[model samples]
Target: MEEWERWERRVQTAAHPVAYRLMRAVAARGPAVRVPRVGVVVSDAGLARQVLTDTEAYTKTGPGAAAALWSPVLGSRVLITLEGAEHAALRRRLGGLFTQGHVAGVCERVLRAPLGGLERRLAAGEEVDLVGVVRDGAAEVIRELVGLPAGGSDFTEAAAVVSSVRLWRRSLTGRQLHRARAALARLSEAAVESYRSGDESTVPGRLRALGLDEAEARGAVGLFLLTGTETLVSFVPRLVALAHDTGRGPDEITDALVEEALRVTSPTPVMLRSAARAGRIGGVRVEAGERVVIVTLLCTGAYGPFSPERDPSETAGLRRLWFGAGPHFCLGMPLAMAETRAVADALRGFPDLAIAGRRPARGVLIPAYARLSLRAAR
Candidate 1:
């Protein structure tokens, strides 16, 4: 097979299996391989850091596919889009909200409320679709935190927005692209309204505290919903599935496992960056304005580099790229992690929990189950 064709085939494979394909590419051409218009994708973490963190060489560039969808919402300057000082400031401002106490408090509330109710239903011999249960739970935490109306439908609707964003970024056609933009705009407007009233203490409060005006708050909130929902929904079920497969009984399921799952299965795969200046990494030279997709999952585990034993904190290694790295690290990391762990712990308590049918869907960006069926303990 041709080199580029091999890469494309790899991209289409499952998350766990991507490493072998990556290793082959690294072997064939050594660590740095030309990914057509994407410049060079470095499999080495040190090299990736040089390319991504150097700032002078690589700039924060979204993948060719969703850049348009996101560019409008986050603009070319939010923490996700901006580089250097601007990105740092934004991250710092948002980081305060996810402090340990803040996250723990949210987790307690999540466990006490929706998650507790779901467990009760499951324990009653109810054939609960754990996917829907967990997805709705996570969605509620997000919406409540952000002040959105609850109905369970918002989770699916938000997922659609996320899916549309992915489709447009990849290969959406004219009409499809137009529809996606319209949907994003409508969602953005709704997201903004939830935070408008001074009485509301949603995510908009944080944006307002940051001094963002109405439109800026709308854009930020839209970005929050898009990015937040996908990660939590994707990880929550996988964590439960892992617990089921490992025979980790209620007693065995711990926050450690949840954090481990987050690290091991990084739902958010690539962190895209464009070269700011000419530079070389992984023994390959990159020119100015070149795009580089840093495969974060590859660096988190496997042969050498960033060992799990190195960081023994409650969720340290698990969150390696959980929020991403450099200037674009996620603003919602703390809340997402808290909610995911809470839901996982609650599900673990239901010993009879079994995934009925339907496998997960993997992609270049988002990864989750299309239909995660479930049945009562049997």
Candidate 2:
């Protein structure tokens, strides 16, 4: 294996040793395989897209789906847990927040100070932990989006809730549910206050202005806290690492290279949907209520190793499947790209940035470097 691929594997296995191994084993079986306890595992991009877009046969609200896992803690009205008209309407109401201009503004406003600090540190030839830099920047952006005070919520608490989730379990256990609710409740307190104030300056107030009820606004905050933070924290450092490992300096890190890194890393490594009715996914029969685990890493990895020199057409079939497809396509994608570009741009100023060391985070739902130290290459 290539050095970069080996490190990526370490990141995945450290976070989810058994689960990652099991997913690879399932992928080896075929495009789609029905495991005894894991339900139907789909490792083919086309089949995965079919399941994602076929709302009539597969749903996020069905038994063992995303709703079953998150609704209890985030409440029932959050966008990730809803379906049909309700989901669409919620997404529409919240759509303005993520427009290219708006998200770009948010990243510019929130990331400038931290990213500037990063550049200054690197320019001084001081070793810096890129993971921590990304984490602090992501936390600040999320705080701005959620209308929380700088110290209002601890993101690590929300990460704790996410870490408790297991790959095979359909729902959190009773104790897990209790802990999850407590963590979210603490995180959403300031958001609830902002929603009550009806001050449009804050995100909760904007949701209130958008005609979302208090519960909906609160649920939205929790959803953003969970979704917005970890994915970027997981991806940005990996992107830099991949560029370094492949001997591609910051000048070569174009939009296409960023997209290719995303495909290879597959930040959100797996997606879950429950069968709403009996159906066939790539010739594999699945019954109602069965889980469909889309091993996104495997699906995208099937394309081949990371190679930005290859034509973008090689990954056209994916349609940015790493972000997702259909109605549930990542609402935060614009913001994610903006944040990614912001960091990548900052790094671009230093062509000789190199990885000093890195340590993978363990026992977390998202695989990421707990610490990736970088310095100007000697």
Candidate 3:
């Protein structure tokens, strides 16, 4: 196989066996195809955009993945479950808190120490466990951003809560349900203090400022905290590996490197939507209750193999759909980019950085390495 093809295979394999098979099957079938009990898979970028943003036809409510996965913890009224006026009102109230400048400030304060430590260690030729550092650092940063108190144990505990629940998003065992509820309770308790003590600078504080009740504010805060934690944990280490493979970083090329890595890694690679009313996506018939799974991993990589630079076109399909499209685009785009940049910059310091070993994670929400050991080349 050619180089890009090999790297693409690694990306698919890293996402895990089930997801790899899912994408391959969807690709072979067509852009939009239905499967047994699974729903429609929109592998093409254009069709995926139509489904994700077509709120009138594809509701985030009803039997949607967001509702199934997030409603258990965030309650039924959080942004992911709300539709029409409620969704817009909630988004408007919380919008100012996540502006580019505000998010950049959050990243700087929350991630500076960790990024510095990584740079110094890598530059000094010390070996590093990229998975542990990024995973722990991601938890720390998200907690601080949401105004929650951080203890050393927060990382492992937080990850366990998310992971245990994530694997059973569609169907939960009794034990899994209990653990998820327990974790949500802890998060809500933490948010109480943050709401009362924190200022509008923090997310929970901003949630309270919007006049949401204590319970509502806590749910909103949990959603924001969970959004950044696991996804960044996956993105940081994978980007480091991809960067080393592509040999693009540090200099003027750093921005290109980060963009490409995010494109390929596409941290939260799948977006699931349930059809509200019978409709057609790219002319494929979809029924009212069937779910639509937007395979962004396939959409973004459709044009060709991964490259360091984004297409400088107003009509680029990958950019339009990957971070999502229309009103529901990712709220943490700036923060996500900042985190990716910080890690890429540090990795750039070791021009001869090489991955010593990597073991891919399975049966988790996002694809990532359980361990990514790295050493600087002499």
Local accuracy by lDDT, each model: 0.59, 0.91, 0.71
Candidate 3: C-alpha RMSD after superposition = 2.5
Ranking by TM-score: 2, 3, 1
Q: Give the clashing pairs for model 1.
A: 57-275, 57-276, 59-274, 65-169, 66-169, 352-377
| TM-score of every model versus the real structure | 0.80, 0.97, 0.90
Segments in model 2 whose C-alpha atoms lie over 4 Å from true places: none
Q: What TM value does model 1 have?
A: 0.80
User: Once superposed on the true structure, which residue ranges of model 3 sit more than 4 Å away at CA?
Assistant: 2-8, 152-155, 165-171, 196-203, 249-253, 309-311
Cα-based RMSD of candidate 2: 1.2
Candidate 3 has a TM-score of: 0.90
How does candidate 2 fare on TM-score?
0.97
Candidate 2 Cα lDDT to native: 0.91
lDDT, candidate 3, 163-255, per-residue tens: 665422564557755766677667667678768875776667777877776766877776776677778878777777776566643433366
Give lDDT tens digits, candidate 2, residues 155-268.
Answer: 777777787687777889998889878888888888899899999998999999999999999998889888997899899999999999998887679998999999999999
The digit string of per-residue lDDT tens for model 1 on 91-144 reads 666665567787677568755876677777777766666667666666666655
